[model samples]
Target chain A: MAQYELYRRSSLGMALTDTLDELITESHIDPQIAMKVLAQFDLTIAEALHNRVKAKAAIKGHLHVYRFCDDVWTFIVDRPTFKLEGSETVHADRIKVVACTARAPPGGKPE
Target chain B: MSNQLVPSVYTYVIDEVCEKVAPTFAEMGVGQNVLAELRQTWKRKIASMRVADFDFKESFDDGYGVYDGAGGQYGTEYYGGDHNDSSFAAAANLAALASGVGGDGTAPDSYHIPQNDGAGDEAQAETSKVVETAQPSQREIDELVQRLWQERHRAEGEAAEEQGRGSLAKQRIRQLDGVDDDDDEEDEDDNEDGIGSDLDDEDSEDETADVSHIILCQYEKVNRVKNKWKCTLKDGIITVNGRDYVFNKAQGDFEW
Candidate 1:
C-alpha cells in the first residue's frame, strides 16, 4: 500500500508515476498466493494533449497557443505517480513541461 | 387478427437460439462468436417487433439493455433492473457454457425457465404509453466514465510491463495493488446500496491523496446508430466515436 501511495496522489506528476506502479502490481499476479485472481491486462498506448487560455500573466508578449497534440516521444512525464486522462491543456510561459489532468466528474471519486 | 402469439412465438424462437448459442461461444472462449450470436438473437427479436406492429428500435431500445421510454430517445440509461437474478444467471450461464455443457443450437438440459405468457403484451403496451427520459443521473454517468478510465490504465500499464520497461511495470504493479486499498476506502465510503459514496468521501482525503497521477487513454469503437457505445480507457482518457473524454479521479478537480 505504501508503494502505491504515489499512484493515488492528487498531483499530476505523481499520478503519472503511479500508472507505472499499477502496471507492476498487475503483472505475474498469483491468485493462490493472493486474495483473488489477477486481472491481466496491458496499457500499450496513451495520448497526452494540452490547450490553454491564460487571463493574466506577468510578461505578456505574443504568447504562442500551439496545438501540441502532435509531439510523440519528445514529451515525457517528469513524475510517474500521476495518471493522466481525458482531453485537457495548460497555459503558461517559459514552462518546461505541460501535463494535463481530467476534470473530476460531477459526482465525487468513484466507489 | 389482433394476434399477439406470433411475436411471442418468434421471441421464443430467438430466445431459444440465444439460450443455445450464447453459452456455447462462452465455453469456446470466442467473444466474437458470442456477439454474432447475440446480434442474431436481436435480429430475430427485431423481426418479432416488426410483426407485432411495434417499433423494433423502440422496444428493443439499445443492444445492451432495454430503455424505459418511447422512440428509444429519453430515459436512455443503463440496465437498472434486477441484478441479483441476472448476476446469478450470467454467472451460472457462463460457467455452464464455459464447461461445454451443450453444443451449438442445442439447449442445455439444465437451462429451462418458464416462459412469460402476457409479458410481451404488457411490454408492448407499456412502450406505446411512455416516452423515454434520461434515467441515469449525472452521478451515474460520471461513475461510468471513471470506471472506464480505470480500465484504460489497467490495460496500458499491462502493455508497458510486457515490454519489460521496468519503470512502467513497476508503476502498473503499484496501481493494481492500490486498487485493493482504494476498495477498502471505497467500502468505507459506500452507502448501503453501494452506489458511489467512495467518491463523495474523497473530498476530505483529497489533499493527502497523491495528485501527480498518470492518465491512461483507451480507444474503443461505438456505434450510435446501433445504440452501442464501446469504450476503453487508458491514461485517464476515454475514446468513443473517435472523440476523447477524460476521467480524473483526483479530488476537487475535474479537468484533464
Candidate 2:
C-alpha cells in the first residue's frame, strides 16, 4: 500500500530524518536503508493515527485563503481557535491546513 | 485532548516502524544491532524535542534516566552561569596569548629562523631575506607569514575589545557563548513578520512551505455555502503554538 506522505512533514518525521542522517553520516547505514526506514515510517504513522488515535477536534477561524489543486485542499486561516477533545482550546495567529483526498485509491489500502 | 494523545501515538509509530523494518534489515544483511541503535537514536531525538511527555521507559532501561538527568542539567545551567564562566575563561586565555605574543615579539619568530652561525646581525639579515623571497622555498616564509597573521589578528581583537565593548565585542562573546536568547527571539519575530507580509507571494506555492502553524490531514468532505465553509478532516496532524496534536477526525467551520 502506498500510504500518504503528508505526515512526514511533522516534527516526529523531522526527528526521524535527523537520526537517520546522523547514522548515514557515521556510515552505520546506507542511504537505501534509511529510505526503507522512512517508507516504513510513512506506513506506521498513518496506521497508528488511524487505529490508535480516537480524539476529535473542532476548529473555527476566518479563512484567509483556500485552494484546491492536485486532489488536495489547502486552507489558510487567520486567528484560528482549535477546541480539542477536552474543554481545552488552542489559539494561533494563523494556520495552514493541507488536506488530501480521504478516499483510499484502488489497491492502495493496507492489508 | 488530542495533544495529550500525541505522545502515545508517536511512541506507537516509532515502535511499529522499528519492528516492521527488521525483516528488511535482515534481508539486506545489515546487523540487527544497527536497527536497535536506530530505534534508540530516533526515540532520543524525538524526546529531546520536548513536544510531549514521552514514556521511554518501556523500550529500553538505559534511555530515560540518563537522558533526563543530563538534559535537565543542560537546560538549567548550560546556558546560564556555567557557559558564561567557560567563555570568559576562553576570552581571558586568548587575551593572555595575545599579550604574550606582543610582549616577546621575537618568541614566536624564534623557531621559524634557520639555525645559522651564531652571527646575530647576519642571522637577522638572513631572516629579512627569507621574508622578502617569494620563491618555492616557502616553509620558513609560510611560518613567518602565519606568525605575522596571528599578530595582526591579536591586534585587531585587542582593538575591538577596547573600543566596542558594548556592541561588537559583547555580541561576539555572546555569539560564542550561544546565550543570546533575546537576539533569537527578535530574529523569530522578524521572520514571522516577513512571512506574514509575503503570505500572498510565490513562496506559498510550495506544499511544504515553512508556515509556523499547520495542519496536515485527509479530508472526508468539505461543503461551502455563501461565505461559510465546513470540513470534515481525518487522520490529521496539527501543529500550533509550538505544540503538536493528532486526531482521528476534526470538524472545522470557517468563513471566507
Candidate 3:
C-alpha cells in the first residue's frame, strides 16, 4: 500500500502524489484510512476491469462533480475499518482522480 | 427460527421482486431487454458508488448466485413475467445503435454463458467465470503483451517456413519480424501493388516505428489520454483503417 502512489499528475494534471502527501502528512488524514479507501477502489472498478461479461466503465462515478478536472473523487465507507491509536475507529472515504485512458462514449460525461 | 433465512428463501424473495417489478415497469413501454439492461447497469452503478463491503447476491435473469461462496440459487426463466436476457452492455450497444449513439451494428445474440465444449462441465465452467472477476495486475498485462508479441512472431515464422520463400508470405514475415526491411525494397518498388509496402520505413524512426503503428494505447490503470507516447501496456493489437492499433478489454473504444 505504501509503495503504491495514487499516480503522479492523476485526474487531468492534478498533482495526486503531492496532494496525497499533504492530505496524509500535513492535513493529518490517517494513512491507514486513506490507503484502505484506495485499496477498496482498486478492488472494485480498478480491479475486475480487464475482463467482464460486459464492457464496464473502467472508470465510473455516480456523484459527478463537473467542476475541476482536478476534483478528487471521495466517499466515506459505511463500516468501521481500522481502530485509531486512541480507541477511536476510522473509516476513510475512498478517493481517486478521473484519468481514464479510455474515451467516454459520445455524450457520456467526462472523466 | 434463525436458520429460517434459508438460501432458497433469499433466492425466492429476489425472484418475487423481479417477477413483480419487471412487468409493471414494462407497461410504460420499457422492453424487458432495456429494463434488465438498465437493472444491471444500475446494479453496477450502485456497486461502484459504494465505499464499503456490500453484496446483493443478485438474482439475475439466468439465475441467482451468492458471491465469495456459492449458496443461494434461482432462475428467472421459470418465474418469468418479462424476460429479455441480454447483458446490459450488449443490449445497450444495440439500443445505442438504434438511437444513433453509435455501435458495431451487431444484433444482440450471444449472451455470456459457459461454453460446454471445454474440458469441463457446467459447474466447472461457472467456477472459471467466478474466478475471472479478479482485477488484472501490471504483471498480468506485461505477460499478455509479451506473449502476444511472441505468438505473432512465432506464427509468422512458422508460416514463412511452411509456405516457402520468394512468395509474399516471406515478405510479410520480414515485415512482422523486422528482419530485413530493405532486402526487397528495390523489388517491392517494381511490385507496386502495395502488397508488402507497410514494412518500408518512410523516415528514420525509433524501434517502435518498425512494428505496426499503435492503434490504441491501453493501460494497467484506466485513465483519460495523456501526452507522452511512451510505451503502454497494450492487451492486443488489431488492424483498423489499414493501420495497426492496440486495444484492451475496455469496450466501446472500437472505431472500426
The prediction achieving the highest DockQ against the true structure is 2
By DockQ, highest first, what's the ranking?
2, 3, 1
Error of 1 at A59 (Å): 19
Residues A15-95 of candidate 1: C-alpha lDDT, one tens digit per residue: 222322332244421222111101011101111111111111111112111113322111112211212222223222221
Task: Tell me model 2's lDDT, rounded to 2 decimals.
Answer: 0.74
lDDT for each residue of candidate 2 in A1-111, tens digit (9 for 90 to 100)? 337777788889988998788678768789999999998888888888888999998999999788898878989887899998768889988888998887753336633
DockQ of each: 0.03, 0.60, 0.05
Task: Report the C-alpha lDDT of model 3 over B210-239, residue by residue, as the tens digit.
Answer: 132111223333223332121222222222
Model 1: per-residue Cα lDDT over B22-76, one tens digit each: 4444554545433343343344334432324323445454542431232132122
**Span of 10 residues, lowest total lDDT, candidate 2 chain B:** B109-118
Error of 1 at B26 (Å): 9.8
* Candidate 1 local lDDT, residue B241: 20
- Which predicted model would earn the best lDDT? 2
Kindly list the per-residue Cα lDDT of model 3 for residues A28-111, writing each as its tens digit. 344553344343333222212233112112211222111123322221111212221234332222211222233332223323
TM-score of chain A of each: 0.21, 0.91, 0.27
Per-candidate TM-score against the hidden true structure: 0.18, 0.61, 0.21
Interface Cα root-mean-square deviation for all models: 19.0, 1.5, 20.9
Model 1, residue A33: distance off in Å is 20
- The lDDT of each candidate is 0.30, 0.74, 0.30
